[model samples]
Target chain A: MIETDWLWGLLGGLMIGGAAALYLLVNGRVMGASGIIGGLVDGSARDQWAERLAFLAGLVGVPALAVLLIGGAETHLSGNPAVLILGGLLVGLGTRMANGCTSGHGVCGISRLSLRGIVATVFYILVGGIVMVLARHVLGWI
Target chain B: MARSLFSALAGAIFGLGLLVSGMTDTTRVQGWLDVFGDWDPTLAFVMGGALIPMAIAWRVAARRRVAVLGNPLPLTHERVVDAKLVIGSSLFGAGWGLAGLCPGPALASLGWGGWGGLLFLLAMLVGMVAAPAAKARIDRITQAA
Candidate 1:
């Protein structure tokens, strides 16, 4: 089961990329999750509010429907309140500040060879690995 | 209406992809980040696979001035690497390592992720609202320095 996880990841990744392609080719917008939501929250997306809302609706709604039909998917997220709060805050602020997240910078940005996207991806991955080591092994916090 | 519908369809596919890719699983994400410990390379495969279509899309988009729906295609013009990109990405990385979830999975997992997920989402929203102010302060401080 563990050995075959990569296959699932690849298949799913293709779907994700395909989705990005569809959004780009059809709607002419970059399929960036954080940017989409951030624009709405910050009022910068006032002009495209409806479009963003529709995208979010499907993002949240489809999974919800899936849960209803095939049982809930397990997240295995940290149960610690502090971890959740702090992590969530960082994710929100950081993605907004950087102007992209994994999907945006990683999938979409790198594919296009965007320098900013590439740089952001490199920094986050490097920092993420460092944090994982510190938290998981040294501090045993998360 | 057609635009909105297509956007929804794209979102749906993206969400489904997250679920199918096991990206919604925090443990797996954490494992992938766990370089010094037990490492899972599944995420690398996912990234590689996703790059294929997106790279092709960029190529296709390059040849077309407008999208299929008549909207002008997004122009990638920004190229500067600044403090915001580095600092923000680092902070985001720390948070990701701590929680093992990013914006996409954070939202996608909500349907089944229960209270923990909801808490994270709310906190994230609060952070998003606060970001502009934070960015402004950072900019001010950087300029002062």
Candidate 2:
């Protein structure tokens, strides 16, 4: 059966991609999602703060807007809020250690054929795979 | 001039493809490969869906002269494969599995009242800030070598 998830994935992809591209085009920066948020350290990091907030706000607001404008999808965060919290901490650390988030490194960096980026991306992907395995296979945590 | 713009255009499209493939969803992503044997098979389709659009976008972008922005897209790069790669990868994996989040989606998920996304974002900055010092040490050793 055709899945609504697919459509969500498609349109959502386009919105994110479009924003990243536009952000880069206008600002001439890597569309690293983390960097944008980091800029939120102050009221707004000049253009950095403004755009970052907007981008992040857009990330949340847009999706909500989309669901409101169009419809809602089945996406929901499961597991414990504690899990999500712990998970976020690890990811924050990992992205820093890796020097780029998925959007910055995984999408922007890899596309540029950056060797360091590629290597780092591989690390991210492999680790993601391993974690998924351990979470279910070993830890028995969904 | 045109080339760089076009390249950016292509990259943006590729990213969108990744998003569409459901790669941005932390739970769905972990769900597909959950090794405890609850293996969610949907991730493969996400991968496939991404590849499809990616291939097509590249082919079209490749044929263009000056990108839509009137300049060549800078495709310059640096490829470093070293000890850092191994260590960095290991850390990234550990963090990801533990958090069930990655850089992209974690940031994206912030919209959904993602407390996890916020926490991850915080740590990610700490990590990036530290990367320079780590790189400096690596540089020192190499110089001594």
Candidate 3:
């Protein structure tokens, strides 16, 4: 299962990279989903709303429609509503504050070797790891 | 016209990649974070796979001043490494660990994740909307300090 996981991960990652590359090559925009969506909502991206909307239509619409076709997208979300809300707030606020997220900073930023991207990724992962340890083990909250 | 079509196509491919890579699965993501426990290194492979093509693409992009659709390339990046970047990323990371859902997985899994995904997404949007105010307050505090 682990070995196959790697294979799928690699293939899927390639697809993601390809998608980012295509967005860059064709659209000339960094393929950061959070940035794309955030821009639209924050009033900062109003000028490019059409393109952003189109991108999201595919980002959201595809998966939405795909489950109907392929039928599998199992997610193990937490049952606790509080945790979900807190987590959502943190993700939204933090990604916006930092100007990126996993896709923007992790994939696109690191690929370009941007210092901000690298630093953001490292901090987030480290903090995330620490939080995971505390929440899952020490506190047993998650 | 053409740009919108391409953007949608890119989004579709990206969503497909997330689904294929098992990133949409919270267990897989949590497993990767559980380094001390039963760690799953699959996420690393996904990152590796994603980096290669993206790295190559960046190189290709470096040569062109504009995109195929003739829009100016958006390649310039923030060079500063400040409190906002560190604190924001750290917060985001903590939140991600708390709930195995980041923007990509959270949005991508909406169809199947149901109410949970919907609620999370909604809350996240609220956070996004509220971020500017928070940042302004933080900036004022920092400046005073």
Candidate 4:
């Protein structure tokens, strides 16, 4: 199961990359989730709202359908409401402020060798690692 | 019409990839982050696999002025690393470490994550909506200094 997990992760990641490539090639848009969803409400990309909505529809609907077909997906999110809310807010604000996330900066940015994407990815990953150390090991707050 | 269809198709594939990659599992994400503890390196393969094709795609894109659909390509040229990028990424990283959720997996896992996922999504949307104001505030402070 462990080995298969790695194999599947690679395969799945390939699919994700393919999807992003297709979006860029066919639609000429960077396929960043936060950018897509956030732009809609923020009016930054208001003109392309249709394309964004359509993409989000597929993003949300397909996963739900897949779960129905393959049974429920697994998760390990905290049950604490406070934790969930705070985490959600941070993710939302931070992605918007940085103008990207793992998909934008981590995948697309690094792939294109864009300096901002690379720097953002490095900072986020490093900070994430540090937070994990503090929260999970040292302080045990999480 | 074609653009919307392609966008939707891409989103579907992306969602499926998230599921197949086991990224929908928070434990797996947390495991990857827990380098001091039982670190799961499966995510490395995921990033590696995704990068190969994406790098190729980017290379192809670098040569093209427009998309195959005749739309203008958005090539981000900004290279300035400033406070917003650093601060925002730091906050995002902290949040991700706290909850093991990012926008992609958070939305993808909605079906199974139940109420927690919904609440998180809502709160995230609120934060996203408020992001503009937050940016304005930051600008104000930066300018005032």
If the candidates were sorted by their DockQ against the true structure, best first, what order would they fall in? 1, 3, 4, 2
Root-mean-square deviation of candidate 3: 1.1
Best prediction by lDDT: 1
DockQ of each candidate, alpha-carbon based: 0.87, 0.29, 0.85, 0.80
DockQ winner between candidates 1 and 4:
1
Worst 10 residues of 1 chain B by lDDT: B75-84
TM per prediction: 0.97, 0.67, 0.97, 0.96
Q: Residue B26 error for model 4, in Å? A: 0.7
Local accuracy of candidate 3 as per-residue lDDT tens digits, B34-93? 888799898899999999999999999889979999988876878988778888999899
lDDT of 4 by residue, B1-145 (tens): 9889999999899888988998888788888888898899878888888888888887788789699899878775678887788888888888888888888888877877889888888888887888888888887888888
Assess the local accuracy of residue A12 in candidate 1 as a C-alpha lDDT between 0 and 100.
Answer: 92
Off by over 4 Å in 1: none
Rate residue A126 of model 3 by lDDT.
92
Instruction: Report the lDDT tens digits of candidate 1 across residue range B1-145.
Output: 9899999999999999999899999988999999888899989988998999999999999999799999899866589988888999998898898999999888888888899999998888888888899889889989999
Docking quality of model 1: it rates as high
lDDT of 4 by residue, A23-114 (tens): 98889988888888889877889789888999988888998898898885778778888888998999999999999998888888888888
